[model samples]
Target: MHPRPPCRSTHTFTIAGSRVAYDRWSGPGRPVLLLHALLFDRTQWWPLAADLAASCTVVAPDLPGHGESPMWTGCTPEQVAGVLARLVESLGLRRAPVVVGHATSAPLATAFADHFAVHGVVTVDEPVDLAGSGPAAVVAASGVDRVPERFRSFAEPREDPGLVAAYRSWLDRPSTLRPVPHARHPADDLNPPRFTPLSDPESLASRIQYLL
Candidate 1:
């Protein structure tokens, strides 16, 4: 078994006029940034972050408007991506660290790879697509239109195939798509899946290692 690392502490950074709060477990080698799904906060990545800290420094931030980070306007994948890009630089990472995004935040992961100089990206429970399907398609895809407007705003991209193509085009870097076993459901926004990191840290960590 890997040695149990110490508990992480929350740190704050300012980006785009917002206070981004994150948890950091200091380790060695390349850093890893964990971005959580909508509604949930950075604490969702605690299990995965702890396991990865055995090999690398892990940073999991509460995306704007999630957890302690507050936002005054509607959130978009591009806006969130910008926040993450700034956070990495604020941490003094000389190179782009490995980025991991889960659920609806998968697009955010791709956005990082598109805009930043990242080593690689790992997307869990979803493929790398900018989701040009728009709000209606997102509801249909999730099998539920009951989600709040805020969730829809960020999770569902505009109905612009050109934008989707643009995002797909920038994926010149390495990326891995790992689906959670038996957790692929349509109503992801209404009913999020069980915490994979906490429930299956070993498998998740192994996949992340594969990406690294």
Candidate 2:
């Protein structure tokens, strides 16, 4: 038989005064919200979302300024959380669905945990350093090496520490922020792509499967 197609669809909604676009992949178990790292968009979650759709629903949204989402000037973690909270409501996911974030978005995940009903938070690669209160700390701790060419110019500002601190304050429970470990970067694939959900989906999906 041919490989099974992933049960997925696209949707748009107004949140925080901007229209946001997202992909919803349906399955059978609990729901999950996937947040992409800085400069990346919801599409980064496709491989893992498709895989996980075999067992659960995965909702991946392009945050305020990325993907099909309108350019939301002055975007803040709080504003992002507010938009996501509304998105969850719009999608009618049960209260406290699990949320996952990659790289810089990890703090956004924490911000979601801070403001919305969430069962837990899962992070992939380079979680925001809780002890760190600023951008330098984020950069120092960032294990990522490459940026998709289009995003290179904004990378520095995106890693701003104030931005990191804005959400790190919300990750409360240590147990809730789960990290997916990678032994080494894939040599051939390295631009070096720091976000594993894009660079190493199978490995990332296995970890997410455990959560599901």
What is candidate 1's lDDT per residue for 1-212, written digit by digit as tens? 33234657778887557678888888777788888754456766665677788687788888666677765353466667787788778767576688877755676777677777777776554433323444333323322244334233323323344332333322222334333222223443344443444445677788777655
What are the TM-scores, per candidate, against the unseen true structure? 0.66, 0.67
- Per-candidate Cα RMSD to the true structure, in Å, reads 9.2, 7.2
lDDT of 2 by residue, 1-212 (tens): 11124477889988446788998887877778888765456766766677788777788888765678866654566778788778877766565567887766766777677777776666656442345345554543334345345334323335544444434543322424334332223341333226566445677777666666
lDDT value, candidate 2, whole model: 0.63
Q: Lowest-scoring 10 consecutive residues by lDDT in candidate 1?
A: 175-184
Candidate 2 residue-wise lDDT at 85: 79
What TM-score does prediction 1 earn? Answer: 0.66
Clashes of each: 1, 2
- Runs off by more than 4 Å, candidate 2: 1-6, 127-193
At residue 76, give the lDDT of candidate 1: 60
How many clashes in candidate 2? Answer: 2
Candidate 1 achieves a global lDDT of 0.60
